[model samples]
Target: MKKLLLLLFSFALFGLWSERNVQSVHASTIASERLYRLYNPNSGEHFYTKARLEKQQLVALGWQDEGTGWYAPVTGEAVYRLYNPNAGDHHYTLSAGEKEALVAKGWRYEGVGWYSAPSNADYAKPLYRAYNPNALAGSHNYTLNKAEQTYLTSLGWQDEAIAWYGVNLPSPLIVDLSEWQSPSKIDYDTLANQIDGAIVRVYTGYRADNNYQRHLTELQKRGVPVAVYAYVAPSDTLAEINAQATQFYHLASSFQPKFYWLDVEDEYLSGGLTDGTSIRDAMESYRLTLATNGASKIGAYIANNRFATFNLDTTKFQAIWVPTYGDNSGYYENNAPDSTENFALHQYTSTARLKGYDGSLDLNRLSGQVSFAQLFS
Candidate 1:
């Protein structure tokens, strides 16, 4: 009887301890949920998930949440919150203007915000909006129109004159050497001497391998500014493109280019990766890498066709080089509707004569539409 009683007591104690442990775990989970809830104490609003917070509805109103479920920072009358999975039960707040701006840029705010789950669980990562560097009517576009004309007038530009004059306009010209039949044969010294200041070109492995370094060295010797170009090929996979970018990064570091151009044109369209989402993703990744690698200060070169298809965030890139060639009038049509804010460097003549090149190559002149500082600085 004694032995049986002792055994029963032990069993009861074990059960009680187990029950308490279970209760403690349940309580901890409940507390954690509350602690992690996206709350803005300042705004007196709380969000259960990140999806709820990122909604276009919320973003437009300028809602922001503090990660601690504390007070949210408010701008105007709105408050915002964003759930961060990496933060583990933390919420972040967005200003009202930020929300409105995001919505205006075309972000779909929907779904449960974010929650902590098992590491193995699959969760949708947040998608960032695309960056369109060349918007039809932005301040840069407006400046391009006035600056180019002013510079042209200063350079003794006549209505029918085909003379080239140097105005020290401080803007880089958008040039493509792809059409150059014999880049190797051309005298780098002659071309460098003709162009004042910097002469930017699209540099690729194909071009870089074909005596690009030697040509760049020659251009440098002539005291002309040099920039390299990276063509984002459509046929290239993201991995391949990224690897290419890494190569460019090393080269840019060594060359110390004034700027780098992301040339997305024929090569991009010719290959299969034309889907908007894929293009956007690749662009974002590339941009992020550039930014991370301290190459964000560089510029981007885009043609009319790619400009129309991909929505680029102008804020991410420094300047836009647009190609629109035409008659002697020096006016060319852009794919997008005409606006004062269009392009910084406009390729008005593709068949312009160069001293060394046998055939006409894609020639572009600096448009005084905007000050270089306004477009780049």
Candidate 2:
């Protein structure tokens, strides 16, 4: 009876051990499928998941699952995973301390087959950083007359020439009617014919004016692109700014200017208001406001010195219009190199000879001197 009892006990113990082994195997398989193992070639570090790697790298990094034969997110790469039986060999056993160490070294954790990163993981891609928001404003200093336009064309200022004088023509000076002494005196038909394909800028504020309306009508009739400029009050509260913007939106809805320009020159005159918030915070607020309001394109018009002096975050603005005179050469000539990189256009070369309705106006010119396509692209 004793011998029989011992034999039964031994059999029960063996069965328990076998069952535990099976559970362990199942757990490991599940973990393998749920976690993606990554090895950083540069750091010679292995990560159990992409999240583990990202926390360490602060950059977009990724890995692949060998068992699933899937590629994972990496620096500048999209997030995707695959499954392959061969990936089993890629798996590495790691202790808690090892995992922590890997994460500390900029490794990220990600899932294996049929698993994905957490929804809130920072999965944003890096974009081309803007260099200077006010780089293009200085381009307005040059003349857009026939000779000047031709010279600009030679220097690859095609977009500026078109925006200023209309068609990419080499000759035929189409005077800006608004700048004429008697805009109404000039025959609409003659002016239209001259500016058959010239682009024009119109100031469209909340205040209604016949001159602005007439110009809008004529420009629409001529199929020329029009852009509105609003002299924004920097100190104005959000409500006041929104009111002004809404008014402009309604008025220009029909005209549909390509975009709106927030003229931010003369900080004092326009209620010099600078947010005490950090530059990043201020810029973020501005950008969010413009974006939420559905402004197709928003730009800033700042003077050269102001841009240089103010530690403004230029990235918030789509494009910057720097008001510098004469070829934009010496506009920010004395200013130090800008660290913030956000610029699309440069308003260089203002012609002092031209006059607007109010008085001698600064005829600003833009140049393709900068890589605008790359900046905005």
Candidate 3:
């Protein structure tokens, strides 16, 4: 009887141990994200991302992923990422003052790279930063390892102290961009942390936006969902409108973007064209052509209060994105879309001077019941 009781006690202890261990592992997985680190030997730049694919692709491109980095939590404060266009270097910080100073000095804001662990929290780890005074492209390196930090300083790298703590990630908003952002060499990795998804201008009329390819490539590489839009030009006939759709789709097909949108924002499609029938007819043609070409989804981007004027059959589209800048105030969330007409995405501001890119960005949000997964997938 004594031996049997002892055996039962042992089983109880083992079960408790197993349950705790399982809970610990599960908590870690659900509560944190890994910030992958990579080093570019050619550029002498050390890069970090919460994006696994971006890290993997860079490794394939000769950037070395030499094992490990730290895990970021599911929630924390912001650490701003900035890129120097002239110097081709990048910097991260938690100070809005420093970020603004850098922007004033011409460093393009790359948005929040990652959230930092709370400074006041005891469980937080330190991310040591070092600067190489001579390097042009990758002048700074950040690491969570104390030994590596000490070693860099021993080699004469200027120790910048803890640049910021890294703890987490999520995507909540959308932005539409064009050549206006100067896309060729911007920091998409850091910018990716800020946006849930993106809608990029593929072309403005017959002329392709120079930024589309690089924008789509970098954003996709960072695992951000992308959609493409074309600013419509006045079409002389249905054939021209159909050609526009075909051309945009062909240009956009390789990327397999989330959505294709006809951006009808100007009065150029007006003059002689009636928005009710003629323009609607052209828009319908563009929408149908895009769909027939295998676009996963189709949307219409129209000016605020212009949806009814377009006389578009709203039921035909998968989504409708409307730009409604209350006063073009260059601020976001200060005002919502004025027209209560049908719209899935609200482009709230054209002058959203967000930190990620140097120029003003067009900020947007999903309306009603729209969500990131539903829109992108």
Candidate models: Cα lDDT each: 0.43, 0.38, 0.71
Per-model TM values vs. the true structure: 0.46, 0.40, 0.55
Consecutive 10-residue window with the lowest summed lDDT within model 1: 26-35
Better of 1 and 3 by TM-score: 3
Question: After superposing candidate 3, which stretches have Cα over 4 Å from the reference?
Answer: 1-171, 271-277, 327-330
| lDDT string, candidate 2, 1-377, tens digits | 00145644654565587687643211111111112234444433333332323333522454332221111221211222211232221222113454445446554433222232222322211111111223332222223245645664556544332211111111112223232324455444433432212223343333643365677676567544456555544443444455656665555557766656666554453323343343334334554565576666777666666665555566666666654333222111222224233443444322212111222222233333343232222
lDDT of 2 at 64: 33
TM-score of 2: 0.40
Number of backbone collisions per candidate: 42, 57, 5
After the best TM-score superposition of candidate 1, give how far the Cα of residue 223 lies from its true spot, in angstroms.
Answer: 0.4
Question: What lDDT tens digits, residue by residue, belong to model 3 across residues 1-377?
Answer: 00145644654665578687643221112233457678888888878877767787988899998644665555667888898888766788889999999999999998887777665543356788898887888888888778998998999899999976543222256778788788643567666765668888887777888888999999999888998899888867777788888889989999988788888866666542433337777788888988888886888888765666667666788888877655443333345577666678877755444334655567677777577776787
Candidate 3 local lDDT, residue 276: 38
Candidate 2, position 278, lDDT: 37
Candidate 1: stretches off by over 4 Å: 1-175, 178-184, 197-209, 235-237, 267-277, 328-341, 369-377
